[model samples]
Target: MDSYELAIRNTVEVVTEDELKELLKKPEKSVYTGYEPSGEIHLGHLVTINKLMDLREAGFKVKVLLADLHAFLNQKGDMEKVRELAEYNRRCFEAVGLKGKNVEFVLGTDVELNPEYQLNVLKLAQQITLNRATRSMDEVGRNMDAPHVSQMVYPIMQMVDIHTLGVDLALGGIDQRKIHMLAREYLPSIGAKTPVCMHTPILNGLNGKKMSSSEGNYISVADTEDNIRKKMKKAFCPPEIEENPVLQVLKYHVFPRLDSITLRRPEKFGGDREIISYGECETSYAKGEIHPADLKSACTEGLIEVLAPARDYLGL
Candidate 1:
C-alpha cells in the first residue's frame, strides 16, 4: 500500500496526506519518536516502537530518543532507579528486535545542554508564545497550574530535536500531537522544514481504561508467559459487552494471522469455528453467539504464543 493508505489503516492522525506523501517520497529525510524512561516499558511503548520500525523499513532514518531528562522532569523517583530503568528499557528495545545502525538511541540529558542544541531550543521557544505552550501541556499530562519553567520549555527542546536532527517527520502517540504541532509552528521560523507528525491509536488497558503503570493495570514488555497468561485469564472479558479491552489488546499486538488461527478454532483446536478478526469476536460474544470462556482462552493462548519470543528475550 502507499503511504496514504498506511497512514489511514494505522490511525495516524495528521494534518494533511499531501505533506506526508511528500515526506515519504524523500527517502533521505529522517524521523524521530521518543519516550521518557520513567518506568518499565509497556505494550503502549511497543506500539510506537513498532511504528518507528515500520517507518524505518519504509526508508526513513529513524531516531528513538530515551528521554532521561524528561523522565526526571516528570516522574519523581530515585535517581539510581531512573538510571537503571533507562538502561533496562534500552535492553528491552534490543530484545524486541529493534536495533542496528539505522535506529539511533540517545539519552535526552546527553544532548539537552549542548550549546548548539540550547540555541535552537531558544529560537523555537521564541517563535511560539507562552500561551500556545501552555495549551500544549495537556498532551504531556501537565496541567496549566503545574507548569515548571522546564515544562514550558519542554516543547521547545522537542522542536529542537526536529531542527537539529534535520528530521522531516515526527512519530508519536496521539498524546504527543500537540508537541508536534508546536514543532510545525516553530521549526519553519528557525529555517527548518516543519516536520510532518504521525500518531498511532492509544492501546487501552484490560480494564477498559488507559493502560497506566501507576494504576497497576499495565502488562509490561518484560512480563513472563505465566504472568501474561494469568493476566489474560483474569481480565474482564464479558460476552455481552462488545468493547472488551482485552480483545483490543490482542488485536493491537498479536499478529493478524494468529488471530485468524485462534478465532477459527479449526478442528485441530477441538472445535470447528470461524473467527476472522477482533470485531467478529466481539460481535459474536455480544450477540450471545459464542462463549466468553472460549474467546478468552483463545485470546490468552494467542497472546502468549506471540509474546513468547519477546518474553524470553527479556529473560522474564
Candidate 2:
C-alpha cells in the first residue's frame, strides 16, 4: 500500500495525499518519533512504532528519541529506576526489531552533546502563551497548579527536538496530537518548516477507556505468548461497548492479516469472509455479523503471533 493508504489505515489526519507526498519527496527529511521511557513499552506504544517502521520503509530517516528527561520531569522518582527503565525501553526497541542503522536512539539528557539545544527549547517556550501551553496539560496528567515552570516547558523541549533534529515529519499517538500541533504552530514563526504531524489511534484499555499504567490494564511489548493470551482472555470484550477496545486493537493491528487469510481460507475460517477492508470489518461487527468471541479469539491469536518474536527476543 502507498503512504496515503497507510496513513488512512493508521488513522493519521494528514490533509491530503499530495501533502504527504510532498513531505516524503524530501528524501533528506528526517522523521522523529519519541518515547518517554518512564514505564514498560506497551502495545499502545507498538502501534506508533509500527507506524515509524512504515515511515522507514517509505525511505524516511527515522530518529527514535528516548524521552528519559521528560519521564524524569513528569514521574519523579529514583534516578537509578529511571535510568534502568530507559535502558529497558531501549532494549524493547531492539527486541521489537526496530534497531538498525536508520533508527537512532538518543537519550533526552544527551542535549549536553550540544549545549545550545536546551536554550533553543526555552526560546520556543517563550513564543507560545500560557493558554496554548495549558492545552497540553491533559497529556501529562497534570494541571496548571501542579505543573512547575520546567514541566510547563516540556512541550517546548519536545518541539525543540523536532527543530534540533530538523525533521520533516513528527510521529506520535493521538494523545500527543496537541503537543505536536503546538510545535507545528510555533515552528513556522521561528522560520522552521512546520513538521507534518502523523498520529496513530490510541488503543483503549480492555474495558474500553484509554489505557493507563496505574489502572493495571496495559500489555507490555515484552509480554510472553502466555501473558498476551491470558490478558486477551481476561479483557473486557463485551458487545455493548460501541468502541470495543479489544476489537479496535484487533482492527488497527490484527484484522488486516485476518482479512487476507479469510480471503484465502473461506471455508476453513468461516463463510466467504469479505472482510476485505477494515471498514467492512467494522460494519459487519457493528451489525453483529461477526461474533465478538470469534473476533476476540482471532485478535488473541494474531497478537500472540505478532508479539511472539519480541517475547522470545526478551527471553520471556
Candidate 3:
C-alpha cells in the first residue's frame, strides 16, 4: 500500500481526509497517541501501537504520550505509582517495535508540570463547560456516578495535550472521538492548531467480551506462548464472521504482520491451506468452508508468531 492508504487502513475514521493528505505532503510532521500508564500492555494497546508503527513507516514522527498525570487525575493511582508505570509502559512500547529514532516517548508530568503547559491547560478549561467535559469522558473516566473534579479536568487536559505536543495528527481509538472532536471545536479559540484525528476500531477480548484486566480475557505481551495458546483454545469463536474474537484477531493483529496465514489441519480435514488475505479467510469461513476449530488453531498459532518479538523482547 502507498503512504496514504497505509496510514488510514483499518482506521474507523480520520477527521478530515484532505487535512491528513496535506500533512502527508509535508517533508516532516508528527503524530501522537496518549495512554494512561497501565501495568500490563495488552493487545488492546497493540492495535494502536501497530498504527503508530505504520505512521512511522509512512514518514511521520511518532510521539507516544505516557499520560501519567491523566492516569492519576482519573484516579488510576497515586502520582508516584503512575509515574513508575509510565516507565514500564515506555519499555513495553519499545518491545513491541516502536523503537528507533522516529518515535518519541513523552511523560505527562514532564511537560504538564511546566508553567506554560499548565497555563495553556487552565486557559482551555475556562471555556469548556462541566457538562461537555463530563460527556467527553463517558468511555474513559473511572467512577462516573460520583466523579471527582479531576475527572472533569481530564478531557480538557487531553485537548491541551494535542496542542502542547504540536502533533500534525492525533491518533486514538474511537473511544476518544468525543475528546478529539472537542479539540477540533475548541482549540482554535485558544490560538492552537486544530489537530487531525485518526481513530482505530476497538477489538474484543478472546472471550468475545469487553477486554478487561479483571477478567483476564485479553492477551498481554507478558503472556507466555503456552498461555496464549491456552487462552485461544478457550476463546469465543462463533462460526459467523462478524464479532468473532478469533476472526478479529486475524484481521486486526495477524494479517497485518504476516503476508498470509497457514491453517494447519490433518489431510482428513482438508489438510493444510494458506489463506492469502483476511478478506479471503473471512469469506471462506462465512460460507462454512472452514471449521471453527481450524480457525481457532490458526489464530492461536498466528498470534503466537505475530507477538513473538514482543514476547522475546520482554523475555517472557
Least accurate 10 contiguous residues by lDDT in model 3: 112-121
Error of 3 at 301 (Å): 1.0
Give the poorly placed runs of model 3, Cα more than 4 Å off: none
TM-score, prediction 1: 0.87
lDDT of 1 by residue, 1-316 (tens): 5654644445548656678787777748677887777567777787877777667777777787877766665554455666677888888888766788688887777778799888887777666888888777776755457677778877777778777666777888888888888778767787888778888878777776777876767677778878877877777776546457666665666643254735445455457575766677666677776666677777777777766766788777
TM-score for all predictions?
A: 0.87, 0.87, 0.98
* Ten residues in sequence with the least summed lDDT for candidate 2: 256-265
- How would you encode candidate 2's per-residue C-alpha lDDT over 1-316 as one tens digit per residue? 8755654466657534566778766657678887877567887787878777777777778888887777676654555677678788888988877888688888777762376886677677777887777777566535456667767777877888888777888888877888988887787766777788877777888766778888778688777778777888878876654668776776666654345313223455565454566666667677776777676666677777777777888888
Per-prediction CA RMSD (Å): 3.0, 3.2, 0.9
- What is candidate 3's TM-score against the reference? 0.98
lDDT of 2 at 128: 86
lDDT (Cα, 0-100) at 161 in candidate 2: 83
Output the number of the lDDT-best candidate: 3
Tens digits of per-residue lDDT for model 3 on 1-316?
9999999988999999999999999999999999999989989999999999999999999999999999999999999999999998888899889999898999998888888878877888988889889999998889898899999889988888998888989999999999999999999988999899999999898888899998899999888989998999999999877789999889888888898888898899899999989999999999998999899998888889988898788777
Evaluate all candidate structures by whole-model CA lDDT and list the values in order: 0.72, 0.73, 0.91
Point out the higher-scoring one by lDDT: 2 or 3: 3
As a whole number from 0 to 100, the lDDT of residue 286 in candidate 3 is 95
Clashing pairs in 1: none
